[model samples]
Each structure stands twice: as C-alpha cells, then as structure tokens.
Target chain A: MAEIRKATGFIDWLDQRLAVNKFIKVMMTEYWIPKNINFLWAMGVVLMVLFMVLIVSGIFLLMYYKPDIKLAFDSVNYTIMQEVEYGWLWRHIHGVSASVIFLVIYIHMFTGIYYGSYKKGREIIWLTGMALFGMFSAEAFSGYMLPWGQMSYWAAQVITNLFGGIPFIGESLVVWIRGDFLVADATLTRFFMLHVLLLPLVILLLIAVHFYSLRVPHVNNQESEEFDFEDEAKKYLTGQKVESKVVPFWPVFLSKDFFVVGVALTIFFYLVCFHYDFAMDPINFEPANNMKTPAHIYPEWYFLWSYEVLRGFFFDIGGVAAMDIGLAAFGFANVIFMLLPFLDRNTDHVAPAHKRPLFFVWFWLLLIDMIVLTVYGKLPPTGNNAWVGFGATITFLVLFILLPIITKMEANCKCNTGGCK
Target chain B: MRELKILAVVIFFTAVVYWGVEPFAHSQMHPHVAPADFAFKDLGVNSKKGDAAKGAETFMSAGCIGCHGVSSQGMAAPMDHASASASFGVVPPDLSTAGAIYDKNFLAALIKDPTKALKVEHKFNESRPHPMIAFFGLGGDIDQEIADIVAYLQSIAPVTPMSDKQVFADACQRCHDIKYDKLMSTTDKEALKAYMGTVPPDLSMMIRSKGTEYLTTFINNPQKQLVGTSMPRVGLSEKAQNQVIAYMEKVGDSKKAEREDLGYKLIGYMVLFTLLAYAWKVKIWREVH
Candidate 1:
C-alpha cells in the first residue's frame, strides 16, 4: 500500500513537470512571434509566411515543370496553360508575395540599423536577418530560371558569368555550376532543384535559429519614441518624461500590431486578386533561347538596387579582365555586409544615441547615397557612370562609419543634461 | 538520447534515399526533348524559309541525326528527340509529304501554336488523330533562320495538295459526324436537301460570302457558329487560314459533351478549394495558443 501511494506521488511529480514543459512550449511560440508587434516588427513573421508560401506553391509548380532547358519552358507553360487547375494563379502568388515579403524585410532591417537595434545583445538577431536576406536573394535568383523565359535565360547567363569572372578556376566553376557549357538543360534542372528544395530547407533552418536568437532578448522599443515638442522642452527645461508612454504587451501594444497586420493582409489580397503582381510579359512567355539576346536585361525590382550598382561600374576598367574583376568584387562585397555584426568593434558602450551620433548620421547618408546610385545605375551605359558609382560608394562608407558616432554624441548630450536620468 | 538516435537514423535514411534517387532520376531525365521544349524551339525558329538542308545539318550536328534517319524518317521516341510517330504507339504521318499536303504557313503556325493547330485540324474528322503536345516560347532570331529553311523547301518544289478547308465543305460538312453515323459519308448538297430542301444554299461561294473575319471566327469558335448542331468545334488554324487564303481565294466551299459526368468532377474541385480557403482563414490549430 505504501509503494502504491509512492508511485502515485511520483506520477503527480511527473505530471507537474509535463505541465511546466507544455507552458514553456506555449511561451516560446508567443515569444518567438511576439504579440502586439507593429508591422515593422512583423517583418520576420511576414518573411516566414512568404517562405512557406513559396515552398508549397513551388512544389505544386514542380509537378508539371520540366527543369531541363530543352523542356523547362514547355513544362512551365503546361503548368500555367494545361493540366493542373488554377496553376498559373499559384505561381503568380508565389512570385508576387516574394517581392512584397522581401521589401518589408528590408524596411525592417534598415529601421533596426537606424535605431541601433543591432546594439549590445541584439547584434545576433540583426546578423541572422542580414544572412537570411542574402540567402533569400539567392533563392530568388535560382527560382527565376525555372520559368525558362527570355529574361530568365539572360539573367542566369549574366549572373553565372559573374562567377566565371573570378580569376583562375572561374571558367571551370561556371561549367561545373551550369552542368553544361552554357545555361542549358543541366543548368535549368539544377536551378529548379535548388530553388524548389535545397534553398528553402536551408532558409527554414536559419529562420528557426533567427527567431530563437530574437526570443533571447525581447524587442527593444526605444525607437518607437518619436521626437516630440514636449520631450524637447522637458529635456532642455524641466526634465520630465514628455514622450508618449509605452503600453504593456497584453492589450494596448498588441492591438496595434493586429491592426497593422490586418491592413497589410488586406493590401496583399487586393494585389493578389485584382492586380496579379507577377510579370507575365509576352517576352517572358517565350522560352529562353541562348542564341538570342534580349533587348533589355534587368533583375527583379528588389535586386535592381544592386544590379544598378554593378552596371554603374560596367564600363570603367584598365582591361577587359579588370572590368570583370571589378564586377566580381562588387558582388562579393554584398556578401561581406552580412558579416557586419561580427565586424562591429565597440561594445558595452551605453547611451548609443549620444555616443554613436556620427555613425548614425553617416549611415543614414550612405543609405541615401546607395539609393541614389541605384537609381543612376538604371541609366544607359556611359563613361561617367563609374565616377558617379564611386562617389556613391564613398557616401555609403561615410554614413556606415559615421552614423554610430553621431548617435553616441546625441546620447551623451542628453545624459550630460540629466535628461536620460 | 533514444529519440535523438531515432531522429538521426531517420534523417540518415532520408538523406541516403534522396541522394540515391535524385541524381539518377534527374540525370536520366535531363537530356530529353520535353514537348514544351520542342514547341518553344520550333517557335523560336522561323518557318517561312525553312531550309531542309540547313535544318538537316543542325538536326545532324545537334545529335538529332542519330535517332531521326538521314532521310528524315524518325525513330523510336527518346529523351533528345520528340518522335511524333512513337506517340499513340503507331506509325504516324510521314514528314516528307507534310510540307506539300499541309500549307507552309500552317506548318509555321503549327510550330508557333500547337494547340491552335490541333483544334483546327481536328475539324475534318473526329477519328483522325492529332499529335498536339506542349510548346515553350523561344528567344533569339530563330524566325529568320527558319524562314531561310522554308524558302529552301519551297525551292525543292514540294507538291502542294488541296487545302483542308476546300475538301472539308465539299466532301464532309453536310452530315454531322457526332450525331448520325449512317449519314456520316453524306456530302453537303444532298444532306442539305434531305434536311431542308427549299432553303438549301449553294456551297461554292459560301467562303466568299463570309469574309475572312467571319470565316476565321466561325472556324475558331464552332460552338457559336451553328447552335444546337452536333458537329464538333474544329477550330481554324491560323496558318491554315493564312496559307489557304493566299493559295486559292477563287475556289473551294466552306460549310459547318457528356455534361453531367464532367460537371460533377469540376464541382467537386470547387468545393475542395472553398473548404481549403476557409481552413486557411480559420487557422483552427493556431487558436490553441
């Protein structure tokens, strides 16, 4: 009887642990996806949703698509035109959502960058996000080829050729990548496999890590405090709390997030239903023919900024090989940006707003310059493009390096006045 | 530890299977002439002056000569070559006479648009097989090159035949093939008299009476052409109309499924999609949190 009673007691203890485990699991879910997150904070969730949509829709598309250059285009048409019911709709949804999701994520990243979301313990999350962005771009690049359209063919040709520009093993690397001498059946098949399967799997694992890292430290909403007249007056004169107060996560703050998500979804639905945002141009409907060059070759809008940058330096070089080398370096430099978090030297410095004023200012200036350069990147090829691109690059460096210092100075100015206290 | 081991084992097995299966299937499937690929390649090629000689050379050098005979006779269907003959597991039409019998423009249009070609040719007799397959649009200046080849074929003096439109109205338009099997062989005037004698119309100028627009529309959308008629819609091929019109504007006469079972299949899918959409909206599993 005593043994039975002890067993029961043990069972109760086990049940208690299980209950706690269940609670932790629930909390983790909400923690990873914080409630009452603003639309800006919801960028991670949006990216996650977009990734799932791409994978699932891509799987359905893969059913009818032939990935070889010879048959890839036809298979795509078959998916769109024949066989599956409403297959075109799925493909378009995947394509359009990709652009929208990435656009939101970029905004999220920049906002974080500007507001010092990468400061102190939050560096890991920002770093993971940048890595995800790079991978997302790669995913987009691979998926573009599955359509086997004119632009699809040329874009692959141009980008893959960039790898060949890497001295020494460049030519062999290109051959190895394409599985053929050119972007042919082998290239299409490989790209389709990667786009639909491999990249997505990697992205999912990375996202899991990204969110896990985010959960370690709750969202720092210091940026949400707008510069107000009252705050300014209090800082200079009375030194009272003048900014709009932060509400708790359960109700007030959380409801704002819900409203933003609802609005975003409504706009997304409108784009899907009425606009059908994916490109379905007549030229795109045509299959990729390697022998012929397309009239205009441009990357998708999200990559347009980088594409513009690359094109800006297309002409200026000491030699043909040197020009190619320059292009290759620019592409590599993008990947380097992903490593920024680890590269940051100064840490444990409080009042980043005051201490890093120059860094913040220059970062903002660099961002604007990059945007301007990207715009100029779209212009017709000319000798002057290089000069403009170089100037823009200089602007980029100044902002990236100086903005942190500017923000730090501002934070120091506030502290000295006893405003922070 | 046990669960982790099991998961590791499962993952290992999965990886092994994926690596083992993917390479073989993908490598084997890589080189084949997917119908879409063939169609798009054909579209990219200009058919106006298709030089059988130049095409023959390309066909040979591209490894097409291996399966397709030197004389242009095709072989068994393989990955690289799309054997129309191998389709339906029978001896199909010969290509040697296709240029002569079919209009040159029709051939070009077939290369441009396969579905449109099938729908047009399917009109003559429902029993006649149509080898319609997938098509991919192509890039490059393939059209001009194909035009050169087409010109070469024309130089060969390929024998041309009576246009399909001419033969159809004269020989087979009167009796509806779908409705009356016994009257299937009946010609236009006789069938017309049998059906409506007093208002019977002459078939010779019927094409001229209807303008190209009307004829094209009539040929493309036959359901809208003759209401309550048992004749299947054998749509007009763009090439056929273009070539036939150029060849002989002076001659030839032109004259004109299981609802319940198909409906159920369509309705079933609609219901399924609706339910799926509702499920996505509700996200019932998420509510547990």
Candidate 2:
C-alpha cells in the first residue's frame, strides 16, 4: 500500500489514532477504476450530488413545513415557496433533484446491464443498488405526499389501494400503511414521517452497503474486460499510469468525474430555472379535495411506465381478476432489474451489448418499450392509447422473461467455440 | 461514433417522451377551455361614452352603495361582512377598485343580470337563481347606466402599476385568502362555504398550478373552465386582471427572476468548471493507457 501523505504533525497523530492515511488510500487514492469507461458512469457521482441537494434543500423546506393535512399544503406552497426568503429556490432545487436522481439511477442501472456489470461476483453490488433504488423510490413517493395537493392526495389514494389486493392482509396492510381507512390526515402524517425520517435512514444505510459491495467487484467499464485491482494499484502507485489500464480514483478518475459532474449541473440548473414543470404537476398545485377527483390522474413521469403496466391489463384469466395480474406485472417490472445478475446466464462470451446481437436488440427494445409505456401512461386510457399501453405492457414482461433464454444461447454459442468453461 | 450512438439514443428517447407527454398528451388531457376575448364580445353590451363627473353622481343614485361599499369614497356597506354574507349569501365586494379590476362591458352585463354576466346561467337558472339582483339599468337606460357606473369605477381606480398584492386584495380578498400573504377572506368562513357550496381555493399557489392561460380563461368565465362552480365572475379590466394574476405569481413563484438569474450564473460557472475539468482530465488521461 502506498503512503497516503508524507506530511507530519497532525497527519502523523491522526494516522496513529485512526489509520487515516490507510483509510484514504483504500477509499480514494488506491481505488482503481477501469480507464475504458464513459460519462454514463459519472451518473453515480451525479446521484450523490443530487441526494445532497435534496437533503440540503429539504432541510430548508423542513424548517417551516407542517405535517398536518390542513397545514401541509400551506406550509409547502405558501411558507416555503412564498413567505420564506428564497423559499421557492429551495423548493425548485429539492423537486428537481428528487426527480432527477431517479433519471440518473435509471441510466446507471441500464449502463450496468449494457456492460454486464451485474453478472457473477458483482451480484451483491447490483442487489444493494436495487435496494437503494427501492429506497429512493420510497423516498420520492413519501416526499411527494408532503405537499398534500390534488395529485398528491389522489395518487396516494390510488397507489395505497393497490396494497388492498393482498387478499387476507391486503386491506389491513393498506389500513396499517395509511393509519386510516381512506387517505386522510393520518395517511398524510405517516407518509410525512416516512418521507422525512425512516425512508432516508434506510436509504443511507443501503448506500453504505452499496458502496462497500462495489469495492470488491468494482465498476464495470464500457468493455467487459476484467482487471486485477491489486496489480493495477501497484502500477498506479509506481506512477506507471500510461502503461496501466486503470486510473487512481483521486486525481486521475476524479478529474473525468468532475467534468461529467459539471455538465450534469449545467443541465440541472437549466431545468430548475426554465423547465421545472417536469417535476411539478399542475394538478398538484390545487389543494387536496377528496370530494372531487381530477379528470385524468397519473403518476410522476418516473413511475409512469410501471403505472401503465398496472392500468394496462383489463382482461380476466382463469377467473382471476385482470387487475391482480396487472398488479403482479407492475411489481415484476420493479423487481426484475435486481434479477438481471441471475438472468444473464453467466455468459463467458459476454462483452458489451453491441458485441452481442440478441442482447443488444433486447436492451434497445426494453428502453424504447419503457419510454412508450411512460408516454401512453400520461394519456387518457381510451381507444388507441389503451391498445398501445397493453401492447407495451406485454412487451415489457415478455422482454424480461426472454432475457435468460437469449443470454443462454449466447453463452452456448461462444462457449462452444472454446471449452464452455 | 460509439458516444454518438448513445447520445443519439438518449436524444431520440427524450424527444419521444417530451413530444408525447408534454405537448401531445397535455393538449389531449386539458383542452383549451376558453378562447381569449379582450373585447368581451359575448357579453352583448352596447358601447357608450359618459362623463366621469356624471358617473360619480349616478354611481350613488343607482343604489349600488346599498349592498356594496365604496371604500375609496368613504362609504361603507349597509351591513358588516357576516351580516351581509348571511343576507346576500356572500359578502358584497367593496367597489373601491371595481373599475380597476372588472371589464367595463362585463360590468355592464353583470349590472343587467348577475347570473348572465358571470356566465353561470347553466348553474343558476330561474329556480336556483343567483343571489344578486340585476341592476344594469338602475335609472332609465341599461347601457347608459352601465356606462356611467363603469366610468365612475374607472375614474376612482388607482392608476396602473399598483402593487400586485394590493390588486389581489381589492379583487380576490373579499372571497379568497392568500394565506402566504396573511390576508384572510373578508367574509366569514361558514357564510362563504354556505354560499359558494365549497370554500374557495387559496390563490397563493394558483399561478403555479392553474397557470396564466388557464387562470385567464377561468377568470374570464368560471363556467367555461369549471362548468358548475359557484364562483361568480369578478369583472376586472384588462390591466387589473393581469395585475391580479401577477400578484398570484408573486406569492406562487416569487423568486422566479432570482431563480432564472441564478440558473444562468450556475450554468456559466459549470461551463468554466467543466472546461477546467476537461483540461485536467485530458492531462490525466494522457498519463493513462
């Protein structure tokens, strides 16, 4: 291991007490990332920046936010956006980050699948990441309810009702979740508690696990070529950087990371200033009125794909309710990303997607399909739109089911060329 | 070439979603509720000229001050808010800036028939009639009387560029509150709820949620946007309506200018930082395989 810093005095004292130098080397300096990566990988850092912004801006909003149903809307819309000096800035930042983080997460997830980063020994990394994704989705949803507006109330109502499909405990679970029969003040407060406290705590712990898991498998590069981290660290330590296929995390990798971060921030601020409507729904601006339902109710853009899956299935199967099947499919869409590690058939011939024709087609089809679902999700589910939604929903499930079969064939054809080892 | 492929895909997918979700789906979901009409063409009121001095005199003889107050002229309503609310089903708004807020032609139509002027003929008909009685022609000629009253209001109204908050107060404060501004409705809550059938939504966030386009149409005629809402049309002249909407924007998106300015500054900073980062990255990558 390389000495982190040669400086004495405070450093010497800290190293003796906490092995600070060794820790820094392990965490940063000695961290070896493959050189054959791109800006997509920098999404991890962008997510980190967004999470921090969400926390900081959320704290500003929290100082004046009220959890009570009656006061919650005013607390956010009035107190935060209007009364507090630069309150709208905090709101715009928080909303944009909360929404943007999911986008980066989606890109990050697909980038992994593209490079087969989730395969084999890195399964835990993907699992922990998906866990983090779940936590993030939970966090976003709970934060969404804090405003207590028309879309907020109704979306919560419709989503919480899905838990009622659990058969015996279904009704009870929803009641337990909401602390009430309907989405009332009790539901608002609990969601507020989850949004502000419990969900974030879980997310932080999951993030720690996610990073630690990444230490072993490391980040996948644009190509699937693996590197010996120990050997790469030796090369980096000896300043054989030009000869090494990896870069040290600190000055080398981070310089590239900073470039990506800068570009991301530029986009983020542009949206925050100009196109913030993407994060905020106009219907949500109206205060929660349980008596009146909005003509068309839809989830945020991030959840639209899965939401469409839920709304798509309208036919009965063996007397089973069509919606129950749709609910299962919705649950499956969310859970399938984590299952990618197992579904890819542990292919030895697997490189990047472009090298594998079947996987390449599947990846693009999946991407386009999700986007289609998202678009159709927002439209009224009538006539041609419903048919399109159904088609997209079926395609989404079929693609996932088809993953292992496709990868199994690729594994066989390439492995047969050698020893199948 | 590889990076271009990825960028191309990203752009393609983004265009698909943006095109589908925003303009395409948005139009389908929320159709244009009402067309813009600055001239109040549908109100069917005649144009006539009147002297401001004559308007001031006739504004009194017309008995408008009986229910409504002329606060600018030191005349108060015959009854307080609650008493008037109980009697009239809602508090009659003060006419201090009625000329400033309401459209002259619409005011003419309103004075002729409160139900028709408000465009709530569908909701409040002969049986379930409106609370306020028609009084466009209080003396003799309907158009002449309306012209005189409107001239009176125009003369009394504060000139353009009064604070948005003040405009909101003069127009909306009688029925709705901007709690962010610490301004409550003038009428009692129970009375308002009883009259309107539901409490009016706070205007603090209206600019953000409903937006300028929807608000303009809705304000122009409530029935056009929300078909059966009990909200009466408060006729504000063009400048005053814009001012009222501007005030809502003040409370809803107060830091818009600052946010926009900061956005540009941040983008500038990021561009510079990214350039430096690119330089550093090139230097670093040059030292890598």
Using lDDT as the measure, which candidate wins?
Answer: 2
Which lDDT tens digits does candidate 2 get at residues A1-421?
6456655699887887788889998888788888887778788888888898998998988899999998988888877876688888888889988888888888888888887788767889889899998888888888888899999999999999999987689989999998998999998898888988998889889888988888887877887777787897788679787777788788788888898888888888888888988788778888999998999999888889999999888778799899899988888988988888888884555477777778889999999999999999999999989999999999999999998888877777744341132
User: lDDT (CA) for every model shown?
Assistant: 0.51, 0.83
- Fnat (0 to 1) per candidate: 0.00, 0.88
Docking quality (DockQ) for each candidate: 0.02, 0.69
Q: Which candidate is the best by TM-score?
A: 2
lDDT of 1 at A229: 32
| Candidate 2 ranges beyond 4 A from true positions | A1-8, A415-421, B51-63, B71-75, B136-142, B145-163
Error of 1 at A83 (Å): 4.1
| Each candidate's clash count | 49, 7
Error of 1 at A415 (Å): 6.0
Interface root-mean-square deviation, each candidate: 18.6, 1.5
Q: After superposition, how far is residue A230 of candidate 2 from its true place, in Å?
A: 3.5
Model 1's alpha-carbon lDDT is 0.51
Clashes of 2: 7
